[model samples]
Target: MPSSSGQCTCLRPFLLGSLLMLGFLLLLFTYINPNMDSPSLGMYFRPAPSCSHWANQDNSTLESDNETHHTTVLIWKWPFQYKFDSDCGVFGVQKCYLTDDRSIYNKADGVFFHHLDIHLGDLPKIPRPCFQKWVWTNMESPDNVPRKPWLDDLFNLTCNYRLDANIPVPYGYLVPRNSEDPDFQLPTKDQLVCWIVSNWNRNLLRVQYYNRLKDHLQISSYGKAFGKPLSEEDNKKVVSSCKFYLAFENSVHKDYITEKLFRPMSLGSVPVVLGPPRDSYLRHIPGDSFIHVNDFASPKELADRLHHLSKNPEEYMRYFRWTKESKMTISWFGKEHACRTCGYIQKHRKSIEVLDSTASSQPPHGLLTASSRPPHGLLTASSRPPHGLLTASSRPPHGLLTASSRPPHGALKS
Candidate 1:
């Protein structure tokens, strides 16, 4: 055995040597090792690039692509939610609108369906089976009542419409012209003036409501209040010359389809619609197809977007890409339908037949039980089908409702 002092001295050297070796190992692992599993021991680390760099790159790519491609548009007049016949329109015209039965045969321009449903809604529940489907929000009879209760049933039966698909029409309405000729002479600014023709007081009410827009843009207003109906020549000139037009509806309503949205696009003028959220309109129309009052954060913000478009003719003309391909028009309830959503319905004849078969095959007890239960969460808020029309009191929050629940239609008596 060693002396106490000697033993202590020996232990001190051993302990100190072990600690030094451990420290060396830690340092080596931390600074030099690339494959170290320990986070603190990793050899390389760096911060992410700034948002501005990513944004700039994205914007540059968008600008370059836009310059190279031509944009095409299909017009539809039916409500955005209705799915009807598919075989009646252009090859791709399944997505375009039709003015009349005759327009389906004329596809010299590109296809023009009423709306495009880019977002695919719930597959199992939507009445029409398609890879994609638009909503036909505009379909209304002469009395302005929706012609079909099936539409109401669809809204009541599915949360699928909202969750699976974005609204189909860009704006609730669109303007299209008869002539597809690109060289067609548009009206001059001096020849064209603001025009409104409606029996409803709401038309003038909106005029007064949005007077500031007229003043800022220096546009002139004329109609029954100002004078006679603008002549065809004058109307053509007015549309051709003016950069923008006011496409106010007689009444404010959700998913109300009107000619106001259509006439502006027809004449190559930007229509500024005064109802619903801009997103609601975009659900049906192409991106940047029309201007919505809701798009502006404020009235002043709306003025700014208008001013930008006014100054930039190229930007304003960009909207014409959808219209110029074909002078598509909206067709109502004929054998041939113009709306893409409607076409999708027509295309899936087999699936609809299957649904009918399944319903028929179900035992009477099961059918009765299913009918007694309320529509699934998907069908809430939407108008009741003919079989089960839920009253306004029964309408569910965030659920689908019939176009009848939509504004002007809602006001109409059932």
Candidate 2:
């Protein structure tokens, strides 16, 4: 037999070889299958796809040709589909394509829907795994859409850009003073006051107010609910002829002002707005530009004021001064809205979820009063918000994986 020293030397080589093999496996395991349970490793193991790099290489481009390079936005609603090329980019470079093809819904960069049209309960689950989902609602009021707890968690963005005055409407809608046009002249007076109402019975408050106003003075009414519907041009001409137009909303809500207020304001007629509180209007429009129904003690008083304005051309024309100095733009809610959707998706590239209570904590200008919250049963378990559930912030919530680390919120319904 070999000496004890030789045996010890041979054994050392074998033991050393075994130790090296074992160390190699441990290193390979650490690299190939990381400990996902570790908080630090969790992020590294399952990294989120960067939103900016998701489509830019293929679908998205900085090119002016929208046809060649544009982010596709699927419209779930057929009637309210926003398809016109408003070219809403930093410098007229088209970047959004709003479509309605189910085939593209999953692949679409975003999905768009209106509050009045969609009901989430019926859908059961989101139709497609879109990168973003947008809801457009200008109709939610204390009496209409209820505030749901999940709204902040559901939608990725709010298509209701109307509430912000900084976002200008379509270019064609802004009717600036045409001093150069020989045909242009001061709007001639026609009816004392006009209301292009379609909801005659659904809203008892509106119908009751209309009746009370009529008791004092005559107010012409048009639309299927009252009379024959006027054409767009005819409606504009009629509103322009009138001294005042009732821009009452179906229901009152903060920042719920709609085209009812804007159309009359654009046409040089004083708008008697009745949707949001007067303060909300002041934020977006001149305080003197509109007459708030709440400001009047009674319908008779409102009618009297309207009558007085109709008689005094100088007093009535004062409402037009804001328009004279700075032209008012009306959003072609359809096309301009689509442009905004595109512009938003193109710029923002991050995963996020907004918290409702925080997001809707304040209105565009102020806090939500107790009256703004819906009464019990306004939001049922099965109740589907017409505009979907949540509105999103442009930035990603810090530590997006953790619910508690969510970013601050924004508004919905309004």
Best prediction by lDDT: 2
Candidate 2 to native Cα RMSD, angstroms: 14.0
Worst 10 residues of 2 by lDDT: 395-404
| lDDT (Cα, tens digit) per residue for candidate 1, span 48-97 | 12334422445455344323322111233323444344343332333333
Best by TM-score: 2
CA shift of 345, model 2, Å: 2.3
**Candidate 1 lDDT (Cα, whole model)?**
0.39
lDDT tens digits by residue: candidate 2, 207-313: 77878888999888887677668765787789888888888777665566666777676566888877667887775777877899899999999888988987887
Total clashing residue pairs per candidate? 68, 7
* 58: Cα error in model 2, Å: 20
Q: After aligning candidate 1 to the native by TM-score, how far in Å is the CA of 352 from where it should be?
A: 6.4
TM-score of each: 0.40, 0.59
Give the poorly placed runs of model 1, Cα more than 4 Å off: 1-138, 141-187, 191-193, 202-208, 231-234, 297-301, 304-308, 311-315, 318-335, 338-414
